[model samples]
Target: MKTCKEKALEWGISDRSVNNMCKTGKIPGVMKEKGVWKIPDDASRPVDKRVTSGKYIKRELQEEIKPLPIGISDYVRAQSEYYYVDKTLLIKEFLDQKPLVSLFTRPRRFGKTLNMDMLRVFFEISEENTAKYFVDKKIWRCGAEYRAHQGKYPVIFLTFKDVKFDTWEATLDKIRGLLQEEYGRHRELLTSDRLVEYEKEYFLKILNGNAGEVELTASLERLSKMLCTYYNRAPIIIIDEYDTPIQEGYSKDFYEEIIGFMRNFFSGAFKDNKNLSYGFLTGILRIAQESIFSGLNNLTVNSVMDEEYDNYFGFTETEVQALLEYYKVSEKKKELREWYDGYLFGNEDIYNPWSVINYISRGCIPQAYWVNTGKNEILEDVLKIATDDITEKLYSLLQGEKVVARIDQNVVYRSIAEDPANIYSLLLVAGYLKTPKKELQMDGSYLCEVSIPNREIAAVYKTEILSHLLQIGAITRTTANKIAESLFANDHSKLQKAIGEYMDKSISFYDAGAEGFYHGLVLGLIALMDNQYKITSNRESGDGRYDISMFPREARYPGIIMELKWQKDMDIESLDVLADEALDQIDDRRYDADMKNDGMKDILKFGIAFSGKRVSVKTNR
Candidate 1:
């Protein structure tokens, strides 16, 4: 007889699959001996007739491919059942540093929770020979010094990723429940003779969900101490998505309540806690001003801007290439890179793991997968408080241009509204923007040239970020559709009316006095046509720079150019003359030279003039 592992090796499948075959009686002579599957050495591998049918050959090909771990966060299951990327080297990195407390800040769905769970599985003491899980992993390939740390300590793991609630009472209740579950994980403490009576009582209070806010605030310190007493070793505490509740608190108007509770709660767990052997935390933002990690002299933060442990959070270039090769879709490399491969984590070029996996699972079709994972509250907030300068810069960004901004890694949520410049910092850490060039200032902040990461983010900017403008009634959908249709059809009259109507409704007198203001307004409106055109702005073509240009993605659409002019206190007659002069300038400067050079035969040029919410448009078709 052969064991499940042996059969898995012979069939080129996972042991879990062989074990499932035994459980389902797919094998002829399988027996359970000592709670382990015993299969005949001569038994043939079972095949699903439905999947193997010639009519379903395509489905069979899919079945032969290992399933992608779309949302699987469990370490053992992900590595064992799915095509797991070997992130076990993260274990090696952590062991080398051995900081007392480490906080990792990354965007959502970048495998933060899964990585934290992996750390827990690697370090937490288990009785079921957990070493087998890592025997074939990268960590085990390292020397004995690293392997010796496997399953060596008690671990207290908590994930506040789902602790979102509108009221403080409800959020606290959810937190208490999470704490109760973590305490229940260590039920052996109840019967340990090493634990004193008082410690056992406190453990029971947490286990039974009878612990109030006060007890829960100090729950981490107390539980770690009791766990140390029981195991005779200090415990590792891991908190995943620690900022979720804090972000919810800020958005739901319970900011003060959550911040106050977290200050004490985190302080008890990480700040100067003797019971903690090592602490690990993962969140989207650092939330430094809240004093959550204050006075933790040993704290080390690995943010998106840091070089240490950068490759572990997101998939590096080599990793994605291997994934593509494994799935037999290696030909999609260029498309995949163009859509999802522009994220910069520290100095490493990274791909969005969430989107890449989803793209592969969906037959390599590309779309904005990451944007739907959560609400874009940060972008919405930025749009809500955007000043005229900020608006113009955002328009420029959408046109595939970079903007210079200060990036402070210690940005807090409360300060976003206090100082709108913090929007750049928030956008960088949240994965919406990437910094290709950064120079460190004396203030410990980076002055970065930031732009949209990839085509996916550009699409997201048009759909998600611009949709906020519609939500706030900045421009009507009718106006947007009118502008898109008019531009596509080369109907200058309808385009003129659409721009006039949008300016009258959305632009204030103070906002229409500058060419930059009108430029931004027109850019936001024309952005609706992005699906059909590759929009660019302020590019040198022919003899000079044109204000805006739309290069058609397909030959069926016409290439477009617009030169905008604005003057203070202009009469209606003068505005008309200004519009005509703008059109004459586009021709005199030969702005159509770019599209012509690109083999475009049909091109349209428009000249738009704006003054105090009044607008005039003229086009040469």
Candidate 2:
């Protein structure tokens, strides 16, 4: 027999993939012995459904479909070699607006880098007549008025998307390296007669990576001036993922240092610099409150809430439909929409381009493809300061309910912990929540109703968000699994024991006396059963509202209803009576009516009481 690791190596797949295949019976003669998967040595790799089902096989003479650009951010290569979506119209929009300096704030992996590169390829003077890249695109048909600007100016492009470091010193070094590379791109400046000896000396210093922090901070302004002097036209500057280093600083305990450096650095490049023709920046958050763009009055900010360039950053429904049609998988459109669609960028309904590409590339198996792309630090930060009210609202959102919130476009990372309400603002910009309805407030904020975007985000919430909350209390995974097993088995005694153990270990005495606390605790734990049950809380059933309800998604699993009660200074006997009272309340109010109406025959009603750290659970099995 061979282990899963051996099979993974032979199949050129991950070990986890091999184990999952065994668990799902995708491979024959696989067995688990002592928690280790054993597979037959001669077992063949499973045939991919996309290949065998004739979905990708051509029976007659037909053009083969081009590969999707999964993570390609290089515009020249992506447009030439892959199934490039026509985003060249972004150039037309920019030419029409002609903003002096534009900052686009979008979530990660939404084609920010690619769009920026597209702009770079369009405007930057190249010897290869880069206009050919856009000749077949939508922008080319817009007439020569837009095409006249192609390859007209020198462009200074730098992407800080990968400059993630744990220390200010290392971050500075990475920045220096990036500047050195940008300087290397414009090597003509070293020999240009337009630049004086002193300017060339500074240029050489930056190009050779021997520049200090002061020189590096002044690098953009210097390079733009030299390029302008040589080309007799002001240079355009593009910075991709500009806030990556800033986010790293905030998370890595070097916020002030990075913020201070960025202030001077951005000021030199953009603030009152006549050498700059047009500047562009893209990041997840605006970070305006950090003073990074201070005193740049000419700067125009286009966020997800803005209507000017909404559809440019992400894939629209039409683009996705066309892509699906081209791939001959138009039937998967509904499933793709459920998993990857539902993002609202202004009035345009957008889908995550990254996840959509990944879904199609991976045989249309729907999962949280976008969630795995980056760390969900924004959600983690929000959960750390979550109040009881915030917790309840989050639980409601997880259960597919909408809640109203005020979204401030200028929200910063440092201010998130000070005001928990800013969590919604962060969540919206970071693409965790979507605003279906919004009204502009007088203070430049939006009063919006926000909810989880789609099924993929709901799954991410139940797993990442809930798991992080449990981890904060040092709760073991075994404890969670035990609770889920006990509840599913209808073993009220085991469930009661599990609840008591969790409360005893995780809850503080000061936090246990409130009924709302217990409600939140139980709701968080029950949220883990999302795969099997459609979890709901504080929803009206038949006659009244139930505290928590688990309507099983399948008829095989029993429906669950939990009624919680808490009182201060209650002894064990009083707690027991309170538990029974809770059970009576559930029955009297007919909280199980909705479950019964839905044809759920096996219902387990749990009445849970709490006083201080003690818990009593009584159930009508």
Q: Which candidate achieves the best lDDT against the true structure?
A: 1
Clashes of 2: 0
For residues 206-232, what per-residue lDDT tens digits would candidate 1 score against the true structure? 888898888899999999999888888
- Badly placed stretches (over 4 Å) of model 2 are 1-63, 483-505, 508-513, 539-546, 569-571, 588-601
> The CA-based lDDT of model 2 is what?
0.86
lDDT of candidates 1 onward, in order: 0.87, 0.86
In model 1, the runs with Cα more than 4 Å from the true position are 1-3, 6-12, 16-64, 487-497, 508-515, 531-613, 618-621
lDDT of 2 at 613: 76
Q: What is the Cα-based TM-score of model 1?
A: 0.86
For model 2, the run of ten residues with the poorest summed lDDT: 55-64
